[model samples]
Target chain A: MRIPLVASLAWQDYRNDAWLSACSVLALVAVIAPLLVLFGLKFGLVSSLTERLETDPATREIIPLGGGRFSSAFIEQLGQRPDVAFAIPRTRQIAATAQVGTLVLEMLPTAPGDPLLGGLPVPQGLEQIVLSHTAAEKLAARPGDWLETRFARQVAGRVEARDTRLQVLAVLPLEAFARDGLFAGLGLLEAAEDYRDGRAVLALGWDGEAAGVGEQRVYPAFRLYARGLNDVEPLRVFFARQNMLVSTQALSIAQVQSLSRNLSIVFWIIAGLALAGAFAAIFAGALAAVARKRRELSVLRLLGFSTGALLLFVVLQALYSAGFAAVFSAGLYGLAEAGLNQLFVQVPGEHASHLLAHHYGLALVAVLGVSAVAAACGGWRVARIQASEGIRDV
Target chain B: MLNLSAVHKSRGAGSQRYSLVIPALHLRAGEQVAIVGPSGCGKSTLLDLLALVLAPDQVGRFEFNQQDIAGLWRADQQSTLARLRSQHLGYVLQTGGLLGFLDVRGNIALSRQLLGLKDDGSVARLADQLEISDQLGKKPSALSVGQRQRVSCARALAHAPQLVLADEPTASLDPLNAERVMHALLAQAREHRAACVIATHDEPLARASGLQVRRIHCRRDSDGGVTATLGEAG
Candidate 1:
C-alpha cells in the first residue's frame, strides 16, 4: 500500500482508540513536565547568582596585602596579565596621603579602563583629580571645582609644605568606593614620590636636586583589578605563589561555584531517572499494544498491507503520541515556571525558573528519538502474523 | 484470472492431520465459482492457498494473472505477494472483519485507497445497490449481521479488483438474511466485472445462486489422515 493509505490507517487507529492515546500521552507528560521545571530552576538560580557577582566591581578587584618595591617594569608586566583589567603604580602609603581643602585623603593612582571608576571620567591631566564619593562629601566638593592638593616634605632638615592647584574631574559613585580617597594620574603620584625624595619635580617644579624622572622608576606597590569574578581567585593565587598575597572576594565566588555544581548534579540525576521511567513506560505500552491489537494487524495484513507498511503504521502512532506529549509537557512546564518565578519574587535578579526555545526543542527531539526506537521494537512482532489468520476459522 | 492444475496443502500432524488437494480450477474475469463442502473439508484452506497466504505442499502448475505463483511461493517473495494481493485481490470474511476504528464508509474506502485509486463513485453506487446506503455512516458494531455482510460486500467490490474471496460471507445471519446477503454479494461482484471465489458448506445455495460449484470430496488417507479434493461437478 502507498504511504498515505498506510499513514491514514495508522492515524485512524490512533484517533479511534482515544482513551488509550490519552492515557499514554498523560503518562509521558507526567515525566516530562517535572524534568523541564527542574532544569529551569537549576539554570535560573545559578545564572542569577553568577550575574549578581559578575555585575559588581568589588568582586573583580584584587589589591596587594603589603607595600613593597614594585618597579615600573613589574607594574607594566602585571598589567600584561590576561586576567588583569586595570593596573597602575602606587606610591608608599605615607607619601600617598595628601590634603585637599583641609581634608586629608589617600591618593590612589588611576588610568583609563579602571573598573572602580565604573565608566567615570579618568584624571589624565597632571593638574586634574577624581575624588571618591566619601571624600567629595567630606570636602564639600564637586566636579569642575578647584582645590589645592597639598603635600608635606622634609627639605634640607626643615619641614616644608608644597601645594598644587588641581581641578576635580569627577566623583566616583558611592557603590564604587565607600572610603575617603582621591584618584589621580600616575604622574601626580610619581611627582609626589619625587618631591618627598627631595628631587626636582618638573611637573610641580619644587626646589630640589635635578634628577631624570624616567631613570629606573620603582614604585612601592601597584593597584590591580581582575577582569571578572572568575579571574579574581586565579589571579590572587597566582600572586600568592610569588609570596605576594592579593586581596579578593574569592570566598563568595567559590560558594556560588559550588552551589551551581551541586544544583546541576541534582538536576541531572532527577532528569536521568525521569527519562528512564518514561522509556520503560512507553516501551512496555507499545509492546503490549502490539499484542492486544493482533487482530487488527492481521486484518491489515489481509488487506494487503506489507509487513514494512504495518511497521510504519505502528511507528507513526508512537511519533504522534510523543509529539503531543512534548507540546503538552512544555505547556505544563510554562505554567509551573510562572509559579516558581512568583514564589521567588523576593530574591534579586533574573526569574527563578526559565528556559529557552532550543531547550524545549532538544527535549522534543530526545523524546521522539526514544519513542521511535521503542515503537520499532514492538513493530517487529507484528510482522510474524500471517495474512490468513483473519479468516482461518471464521 | 487464475489457473491451477494441482495444488496440495496440509494442516496439523499425526492423528489430527488433514489435507486439501485442488486437482484443477480455472477462472476468467466476471466469473463466479464456489468451493462448496461440509465443515472440516479444508474449504478455507483451499481459499488461503489461492489467496497466497498459504504455500502449497505440492504443485503441478499454479499461475495467477499469468505470473508463476508457485514459483513466487517457493522463492518466499512475501513482499511481492503482498503487492499482488493489494493491487489485484479483495476479501470478504464471514464476521464482516470490518476494522472497528473505521466507520462503514472508511471500511468500504479502504480497498480502493489501498490500490491508490481515486474515488470513482462506485462506493456510493455499491452501497446503493447493496441497500446499505443509509447505514454507511454507522460502524460495523452498530449494524445488524445482514447489514454488516452487505458492507463487507461493498468493500470487496468497491475497487473492482481482479478477484474477490468470500469466506462464509453469510455464516452469521438468519436464513432469510443469508439468502439476501448471498444474492447481494454475488450481484455486486458481477457488477464490478470481477471473478469471485466463495467458500461455503451450502451446496444447494451455491447451485440456487447459479455459481459453478467445485465441491470437495473427502475420505480417509492411508496415513490415518483425512484428504479432501476439489474438482468440477456436473
Candidate 2:
C-alpha cells in the first residue's frame, strides 16, 4: 500500500481513539520529559564545572618544597622541563610586612604570569609592586604610586631593619589572591632577603653599601606551573622523583571530575529506568490497540490489504504518538533548562548553565528508537492476523 | 471468469473431521451466483476457498480469468495471490465489516488505496447510485443495519474488482431492505461487468435475485464426521 494511505488510515485510527491516543502520548511524554531533564541537568552541571576548570589556571599550578636556595640557574632549569610551563623562585618568609606610611600589610614576592595574579598586570622593574584590592584601598594607591616598606631581621636576638621604596604597577581583584597581601618583584624580595639575613645595602636605604655584593642569592622555594591540568600530575611526579615535595589542586580537580562522572552514571541509570517504563507503556498500549482493532484489521485484510500494509498502519499509529511525545518532551526540556538557568546561576557573575545541542539530538534519537521498536512489536502481531477472521464476525 | 473443479477441503482428521467437495463450478463475467445452504454446510468455507483465503487439500482445476491457480498455497504464492486479490477481488461481509475508524467514503475507497489505484469517481458514483451519497461522511456506527448493508454493497463494487464475494450480505436485514440491497448489489455487479458470488441460507431471496443457484448438502455420519457435497448448478 502507499505510504500516504497508511498514514491517513493511522491518523484516522488515532482520531477515532482519542482518549487512548492521548493517554499513550501523555505516558510517553511523562517518560521522556524526566529523562531529558536529567540529561540537561547532567550536561549543564558538568559543562559548568569543566568550564570553570578550564578557565582557572590554578588548577595546574604546582609548588615544590625544600628546594634550598634556588638560584636563577635552577629556576631556568625547572622552566626547561617539557611539562613545566614556567618556574619562578619564591621566598619562604610567608608573612613579610610592607608599610605604606601608616598602612602595613603582609607582603610576598610575585613572578610574571603567576596564576594567583589572574590577569592582573605583573610588576616589571626593580622598584615596581602589585597590591591586592584591599591593600590598594588601605594604602590609597593606584598604578604609578610609590610606596615605602620596612623589612626587619633578628640578628643574635636583636632586631635590625632596612626600608625600601617601590612604585605600584597595578591593583588586582580581591579574588585573585588568597588574602590581602602586597606583591613586589624579585629585586624587592632579594632586598628583603638581604635585610632579613642582616645584610645592609646603601642603594636600598640601608646604613651602608652591601658587603655581599658578589654572593649568589638563592631562593628557599619555587612556584611552578604546568602547561595544562593533565601535565600537573607529571610535573608533581617529576618533583617527587627528585626527592622534592610538591602541591597542586590536581587532587581536588580529580575529585570534582570523578564526582560529576558518578553523578552522571546515576542520572543515566534513572533515565534508563524511566525509558524502559516508557517503552513498556507504549508497547502495552500498542498491543491493546491491536486487540481492540482486530475486527478493523481483519476487514482491511478482507479488503485485500497485504500484511505489510496492515503492519505499516499499526506502526504509523505508534510513530505518531512517539513523534508527538518527542516534541512535547523537547518543549518541556527547553522550559526546564530556562527555568533552572534562571533559578540557579552556576558561576558567579556569569550564566553558565545550559543543555548542549548534541545532547538534545541524542535524546531525540533514543526516544524515537524506543518508540519504533515498541510499535514494531505490535505491528508484528497485526501482520499475523488473517483475513478469514473477518468472516467469523459475519 | 471463475471456475473450480474437483476441489476438496477438510477440517480436523479421521473420525472427527468435516470435509467439502465441489465437483465443478464455473461463472462468467456479469454472472451472479448464489450458494445456498443450511448452517454448518461449508458454504462460508467454499466462499473462503474461492476468495483464495483458504487452502484446499486438492483441486483438479481452479482458474480465474483463464489462469490455472489451483493449489497455490505456498508462502510465496500466497503473497502473489494476495496481490491479485487486492487488484481483482472485492468482498462484503455479513456485518458490513467497515472499519470503525473510517467514514463510509473512506471504507469504499480503502480497497483502491490498498491496490495503489487512484479513485476515478467510482466511489462517488457508486455512493450516488446506492443512495448513500448523503451518508458518505458518516461512520458505520451512525448507519442503520440496512443502510450499512447498502454502503457495504457500494464499497464492494467501488474498487471495480473483476469479482465480488459477499457472505450473507442481507442475512440480518428485513425482507424489504434485503431485497433492496440484493437488487443494488446485482445491478452494480452487472453494470461493472464483474461476476458476483453470494453465500446465504435465505433460499427464497437467493432464488428471487434471478441468479444461478448452487445448493450445498451436508450430513453428519454415525462416526461424527460431516461430508458436504455441492449440488449441480441450476
Candidate 3:
C-alpha cells in the first residue's frame, strides 16, 4: 500500500509531464530502430551462408586459385596435417589449337592412372581425354576419334604437336567445371609436353609418372581437405604461412554479409545518440519537475518522512518512468520492424534476434543509468533544504 | 505536550550576528496559540525553533514534552522531532506550498500518506470542510490562489496532527478569504482537539479569531535575540 502511494505519485508525474516523455520516445526510436535492422540483417546473412558452407564438403576445397593445378607433393604434405582429412591431387590442363578444317578446338587431357577414369571410352593402353559438352561440339570428334592435338609457343614457329593424337572418351557435363570454363588433368599435358620435347627417349616421361624421384616432382596446386569445414581455416593459415596463395571463399562471403550489417550499425549509432539526447532532456525535465516540487518534499519531511524514505521515493519514481519507457520502446521497435519487413523483401531474416541481442540490453542499461543520473541531480536540491524553508516562502 | 524555555537562535556570528529568542513558552495537549508580530519581528523564527528546523546556537534548558532537547544529537533530534511532527503537528507555510503536479484531492491525501495514517475518511472530511472538495479533481495549476490556499489547509488538517503550525496562512488572501481560511483552520483544530500555532502580522484577523496570542520582537541591538511579549491579547 505504501509502495503504491509512491509508485502512483511517480506515474502521475510522468504522465502529466508529456514533453519530456515525448522527447525520450523520439530519441529511443531514432537509436533503436536502426540498431535492430542493422544487427538483424548482419546476423541473418552470416548465419545463412555459414549454414550452407557447413552443409557441403565437395565445395570445401574447390578454391579458384593459381591457374588450376593440384600438386602431388603439396597434397602429401597437406594429408600429413592433423586437421586435413583427405587431400586429392588433381590437375587441369587446357590445350587450344586450330584444326585442319580451320576451326578452333580446345582439348582437356586427364591423368593416366586415376581410378575414376576406368569407365571412360579412352582407348585402352593409351592416355585419354574427357571433353566438355561445348568443347566436344567444336572439336568434331567422337568417342573413338583420333584427336590430333597441336601445341605452339610462338605463332611464327611451326606447330610442333600437330602429330600428337588421342581419343575423346567421354563428353562431360557442362556444369562439371566452374562457370569460368576449362578443365583437364595437368599430368596428361605434362606427359604430352615431354614427348614433344624429345624427353620420350627417357622412357619414363610419357607415362605421366616419374616412378621414384621425390625432388623432381611438380604439381600445379593441391586440393586440401578437412575433417570438418571449420578445420579448413587452420589448414589454410598453415599453407598461407608457407607463402602459398590461399583464399577462403566461405569466409569472404561471411565478411561481405558482416560488412553490410556493420554499415547499418552506423545508423543505429545515430539513433542511439538521439535517444541519449532525449534522455538528457528527460533528466532536465524531471529535474525541473523536482525543482518545482521542492515544497512537496519539504512537506513530506514535515510529515515525518525519513531522509532515506524521501530518497527512496525519488529513486522509485525514476525507475518507474525508465522501465515503462523501455518496455514501450521495445514494443514500438518490434511493430516498426514488422511493418518495414512487409514493405521490403531485402530485409534480412535474422534482424529481430540481432536487435534483441545487441540493443535491447543496452537500452535497458542506458535507461536505468540515465534515470539514476537524473535522480541524483534532482535529489541534490532537496537534500539542502531546511524544514523552515517551506514555511518561510509562504 | 510541547514546551520551550530559553530557546535562542542567531542568523550570523559576531559582527553580523542576529539571534531569535522564545523565552518560556509552554503548550499542553489540546491547546491553541496564536503568534502575532509586526514585520521584521521573529514570529516565523520562533515557529521555526518550535518546529526544530533551526537549532539555537545556545540554549538554557529548552525541553519538548519533558525531554531535554537541547543536547540531542542531530540524527536523534531529527528523528524525535520528525516523529512528533508526523503524528502530532501540522504546518501551513505562509504561501500554501501545494505541489503543482498533484490534483487538490491528491495533495490533501499526501499528508495522511506521509504521516502513515491509514484512514481515508478523515482526509475526505477535511477536504469537504476546507471547501476544497469540489476542486479535488483539479491540479493546483487549475486552481486560483485562494483555492490553492484552501487545499493547503485541507492537506495540513487531513492527518489530524495534534499540533498545527500556520505561518501567515492568511497573508496572501483578501479579508473575506482570510476570514474563511482562519475560521476553517481554527474550527478544525478545535474539532481534532489539536494545538494550533499561527504566526501572522494581521492584528484584526488575529484578534477576531479570539485565541490566546503572543507577540515577538526581534532584538535590533544586533545580537540576534527575540523578545517574546507574553499573553499580549486574547
TM-score of every model versus the real structure: 0.91, 0.85, 0.66
- Predicted candidate 1 versus true structure: per-residue lDDT over B114-194, tens digit per residue: 878888888888889999899888878899888988998888888778899999888788888889989988887887788
lDDT of 2 by residue, B117-201 (tens): 7889988999998889999999989999998988888888877889999899998999998999999999999999999999989
Error of 1 at A170 (Å): 3.9
Candidates, DockQ: 0.63, 0.57, 0.42
Candidate 3, overall lDDT? 0.63
| Model no. 3, DockQ | 0.42
Residue-level lDDT of model 1, residues A131-187, one tens digit each, is 999999888888999988788899779998888898999999898889999899988
TM-score sort, best first: 1, 2, 3
lDDT tens readout by residue for model 2, A232-295: 7777777789787878888977876787889889987898788778878778877887788888
The DockQ ranking, best first, is 1, 2, 3
Q: What is the lDDT of residue A80 in candidate 1?
A: 90
- What does chain B score (TM) in every candidate? 0.96, 0.95, 0.89
Between candidates 1 and 2, name the one with more favorable lDDT.
Answer: 1
Q: Select the stronger candidate by TM-score from 1 and 3.
A: 1
- lDDT scores of the candidates, listed in order: 0.85, 0.80, 0.63
Interface RMSD of 3: 2.3
Clash totals for all candidate models: 0, 0, 17
